[model samples]
Target chain A: MDFSAVRSVAVLPFHDLVGDTRAADRVRDTYMGMLLATRAVYVLPSGEVNRGIARASIRNPQQPTTDEIVKLKKELGVDAVITGVLREYGKVRSGSAEANMISLSLQMSETQTGSTIWSGSSTKGGISLADRMLGTGGRPMNDVTVQVINDLLDQLFE
Target chain B: MICSTSCSNRFLLLPLALLVVLLLGGCAGLEHTTVSSSGNTDLPARLEEGALYALLPIENLSASRAPLAELDMQLRNALKERGIRLLEPERLETFMREQRMRSRGGINLTQSRALRDLGVAGVFITALETWREGEVPRVSLIMRLVQSGDEPEILWIDGVGRTGDEAPGLLGLGLVKDVRQLTAGALERLLDSFVAARSGAEPGTAAQKKRHQPKYRYRAADFDPAAEYRVAVIPFLNVDTREHAGRIVGLHVVRQLQRYGNLKVLEPGLVREALLSQRMIMQEGPSLEAAELLAAADVLGADLVVSGRVFAYEGDAGESKVDFSLQIFSGIEPQVIWTSHSYGGGDDGVYFFDRGRVPSAHELAGRLAEAAIGDFAQ
Candidate 1:
């Protein structure tokens, strides 16, 4: 339940609810990049995480067992793991030409215990009454995803 | 008292007459068609009320956005109503991720072991042929109920294709079914069919009593009939001069083996991924070395590993010939359990004055695949 001692974190691949893997990957990268910008917790790069996965020869990287977690701890030397599922993501079109939306759930867990310390999710990007009346669109998918990640991180920090 | 003998005939034909009139009235758009093939009726007895079964990712052939998840949810709800246990979606997802099996893809060997450890009876894999939602809703699905075993038996295989339904009329006058009614009705009917089969037939039926077990083609002493088994089919060794011949044949064999319902066939992707992870490069050969086969079985947790190789493939624009051989190796030990060599001729061989008919590579591979493992049905 403590984030003070969580100096470094590895974000695992997020499951794609919309089945658009490219969008999911982009969102995860955006989150990691934004988290890195805060300079609060040093984030492991996805490439490094992938190398660790290949090194561990994990059967299921997303659903790692306590034993697999132990291996990952030794292999990647990460204090915490951030896992997520992308629910609604990618570009959406409304009365306005094109808009983007993102709905995602995330959990940060200690690698040693695989115990969750914090969890959160958000759905963003919809046509407001103003936008509907003016015939305008909301932010693009990346911008919306970044905003959601930022807000969620703010909550975690608080 | 007033009915004559000829009058009785008129009454007998009344129902048929109504059906014809209904067809003429454009009621033909909604007669649901179902095709099913069932193995031993006793096979259903394997499903217990509370036994948990994993559902492999449903193969989505329809051009829809991840409807498999929604459809699977509906299916699980239907199953729950029947007191059937299913693997929790998250649990299955996590387990597959652990084993590196793709949700939209396959069942691997090691993943099968995990399912067993989780105390699952078997796995359900389906294919969505058509899933159109709207005014004229249509749903077509091919369902496979596979038993967990060394050769996982596909106990029940059913296919349904239906679009809307006729609305019920007063006194059988109107035959109309709404989209919601059609979907729910078809789903319930399919579930009932599965449950009834699993509940078992009356033990005293003549078919059950006769019990005609056909002669198996590749009989080896190690072919244990008692315990359920999962089989991992590694990419076949390609020996033909043509490229990807073995892979094509392997694909056909996997498809055919999948239809049998007695073997928990490992998805080819899982096998490929496993081999790649283990740094074991699958080469073009008739069979794997004992150690290599053991490694494959280790990764797949399969009881048996089916290895194959293509020997001959020759074809031009219109004619083709193919030959292939297969061998089953046990994961328990470093030995071949069974072996079969087969060959087949393909293409119509119709001669055109300038251009003769030629079989494509896939056509040849399919023929060879059928020839090699056709007896597996028995």
Candidate 2:
């Protein structure tokens, strides 16, 4: 893998299918780890992308369209826009939380052409620490996010 | 030889008599005989496995309609009789309260979590819709199945049973009877759809299905608790006539988020502080620059922002109802991580705040909180 070729990767806020704000945070948090792990890729801070999205006046930020994604990538001047969708999330029991069954669909495109070079999606589910203390049980949110991100990254890097 | 033959013949007679007596005794011990009764033998069991369901209090959405509460009770009982585990309305209400959540007009995350907790595979929400055709009476129903981890599928069943003139002609059937029949029909159809879906049959695939999935998790195993993230809860949009209803709902939700003691709750005060710091007015509705709000909260810098609205507050002359709709967005990109709507209803008909209904506002609040927490479970 040519690590030097990938630089300044931008992670767009993941789209929330259910519209719960917490799920979006979980996704961003999970993605942060992956970004940090990839030494070659310079990841843009999620906060910056969020601010840009908020400024864009888009409804349902978690589920933006391809066009909106293109516009965001251009505005941010990043190599790629990492987007995701929260497929399912919640605490099935009092403390046991299922954070994300993220359908992580990443589109790596030439920012100029808006043509997708690579796109892939993966479903992942996890439990939260609060859920564990509450005695509820499920997969951890981070685990799900990491797995989804890894799958997405593989598609993009490959 | 003659004596031996005579003895053997006596012994044979005694044994035959004994055998007859035993046979007669067995016959006498037999209870009532069951003759085959012919009926609807093919009728399926009322309750099926992996069927998620919701039992809603029937509401009269028509003029001069029958009380829906009674129908609600009856329908619940009927479903119970058929071996269905009816989602305890009281329990569901409690869970909602503990979570400090209110119902959005439709099935919210709280209900989904509660149902899932109850081991229900799906939910059946029943509502009454009534209208008049000239002087004749007409009644109908809108039933919806909120499947766990799937899209919301709705079914509308309608009809006219009897008019006032036809009512008298029938064998002592009244308005209640007519309404009950209509409800029974709606319930039957609801169950039919459930069974059909489980059996992998499509029931009106043309109808639009609304897919609702959760956005985030709160457990440590899911994410590092130490990982700092900024959550934004936008001012709830009110779909009701009540002023400040959105603020009330928003405050309650923010309080619940803080209670979780895990994720950092972006306080309304902080939102105000950030807005003021940015020299922007913290007013009604989502900020024109949502990104600014995200940045002010440091959400862009943090992890996620939560935002949504108070979509509806319905009440009659005596009772008050409140509904809140919410969504969590990624602070990085303001993506909605999760979404939920909760509702709270109370009877305020008689007593003032000091001596209100037996289930006082505090109790109602508690119930709403349970729902809020339970929604996460669902």
For model 2, the docking class works out as incorrect
Report the Cα lDDT for residue B250, model 2.
51
Off by over 4 Å in 2: A1-6, A18-21, A54-70, A90-103, A124-138, B1-275, B280-378
Residue B137 CA displacement from its true place in model 2, Å: 59
Q: Output DockQ, candidate 1.
A: 0.01
The sequence of per-residue lDDT tens digits that candidate 1 reaches over residues B35-133 is 232334565566666788877766775445446666777788887898877888899888777767754434544555667788887787776644556
Candidate 2 interface RMSD after superposing interface residues = 10.9
- Poorest stretch of ten by lDDT in candidate 1 chain A: A134-143
- Number of the top lDDT candidate: 1
lDDT tens readout by residue for model 2, B246-351? 5444544443443332455443434543444566433223322454455543332335555445544433222334444454445444333344444444432323
Error of 1 at A13 (Å): 44
User: Which candidate gets the maximum TM-score versus the true structure?
Assistant: 1
